[model samples]
Target: MGGKGHIFRKKLFQVGSEYKWLGNSGELKEITLEKRTGVTKELIEKRIKLVTTGIDYHLGHRNCEHFAYFVTGNMPRSDQSIWHMFTDHDPFNIQPMINNFDQLREALLRSKHCGPVGLSRGDFENAVFVSQLDDGYYTYHLSHPLGGQHLYITTVEKAKNFESSYNSIVLAYFGAFFGRGEIFSIVRQLRGC
Candidate 1:
């Protein structure tokens, strides 16, 4: 564990308190980020309550940037982790569940817009693919040969939830973090024909 994770997502929410310096010579710089939505003080407090038990910390995934972006909807990013992903990691294991999968593969191959996505990492190299089945409505799921939950990506709210779940699953299983890929993927998938 690194000391940088030293302060694992400390929540600082003093509205009128003075800024106390905590560095040798770190200069204070202020910049603005356009937010997707305004975050309420009540929401911030509620989220902060989840800082300990409800939040899982990961250098590559749920770093300070993600925490801020999630709460504020500003979507500020840390490129360091992503840079490391490209230079210091294995091939993007979109997972080989795509290969040698018989039952679900056949089923999805028959669907209108079926695709694939793995839910976890270790010992589950062969997971069901996330596919879309379209009739009048579209549905996204792993369509497991044995059955699993379908994550609907039709709305920003639902997509956000799926992104959170995907982040945890990918981090826990693939040993990698998605950063903002979850949101992008959801948006892209939602736009499918």
Candidate 2:
């Protein structure tokens, strides 16, 4: 819980009823509690219970960022984990490929998990594409062979709508036959999208 410097190098362990060494200045980078609402004493108690339970820490899944989110009664997630997943270096120190829409799209298309179903790659290429909005949300577009096009905002519900109307064959970044709904669902399950 406490270390001399560089808190990331410290192993998390409970000391008696409390976590020790939490007073280090290194631990106070970006405090998110100020941005949250509906955080109550009960929520703090819940976080204390979670801490006292001796949960195993995994850097990619359960780090200090996750703990801070949990303490605020929000879903536990770590931007550090997402950053690590996309790059070899610290996110603050280097720009990751994920920041480039073209690079990210190309990388996703090359993923073994992504491709077209029942259609040739050329057909898939002409029919479907993914676009990222200025707000950072991804939108999936499908061009029908008959001349019309459908655009879906990438939310789980909208993905379901796309699935039901498109014969569940929308091209996605994760699966050949699955629609954006499947991708969003998988992301939601992972709790990091």
Candidate 3:
């Protein structure tokens, strides 16, 4: 994290002294938050002190991303944690249920005035294919043996939400469409359909 011409980060080994100053790493990407005031060095140092003293360094709950967000006066959040919450692929331990896939798909499909997307079902069976169209819109495609569907997301927020819920959506689709059948039974059902 860089601000006011200095670069620093919360390193892993330094528990109590986590904040390390790395004089100007030219790789700082500026994050613009509207109505944010200039953060003073004293304020940053205070935050760092509070964090290094009070918070235990936990990868999932309190990491560098959380520190950065906290010091910047934004709601402290870890993008990695958020991503893991959505996409942890442990089959035996799926995340909490997100039950709005059908409704979201229906809404998007109804709003977007496209006929069936030309991609074959096999092209997107295992994953949701996300791509940015020439007009800056995003497309998410998911296909099954029965059919295929795509949603044109106009905003990045919606696109991210869809992508994050992609696995759940796929699972929900199969679960609803195929019932509680095993793989062979699902295949048989599909064939019978």
The best candidate by TM-score is 1
Report the lDDT of model 2 for residue 56. Answer: 39
lDDT of 2 by residue, 1-193 (tens): 3221122333344656544334376452332333435678787666655542323344664567766666666666677776335322221212122333354455455454444434333433343335444444454555445443333333322333544433433334434333444343333222222
- Model 2 Cα RMSD, Å? 14.4
Which 10-residue window in model 3 sums to the lowest lDDT? 90-99
Clashing pairs in 2: none
lDDT of each: 0.35, 0.43, 0.38
Query: RMSD in angstroms, all models?
Result: 16.9, 14.4, 17.6
Q: Across residues 1-193, which tens digit of lDDT does each residue of candidate 3 receive?
A: 1111123553222225332222357333333332334888788766655543322344554456655766765566666776335322221121221124343345333332334344333433444435443343333433345643333233342335644443323322222233322222222211111
Highest lDDT scorer = 2
- Please identify which of the two predictions, 1 or 3, would achieve the higher lDDT against the true structure: 3
Ten residues in sequence with the least summed lDDT for candidate 2: 88-97
Cα RMSD for candidate 3?
A: 17.6
CA error at residue 64 for candidate 3, angstroms: 0.4
Better of 1 and 2 by lDDT: 2
Write one digit per residue (lDDT tens) for candidate 1, span 63-115: 66656654453433455466333222111111111222242234334444333
Candidate 1: give the clashing pairs: 3-6, 115-131, 116-129, 116-130, 117-130, 121-173
| TM-scores for candidates 1 onward, in order | 0.28, 0.26, 0.25
Q: C-alpha displacement of 112 in model 1, angstroms?
A: 33
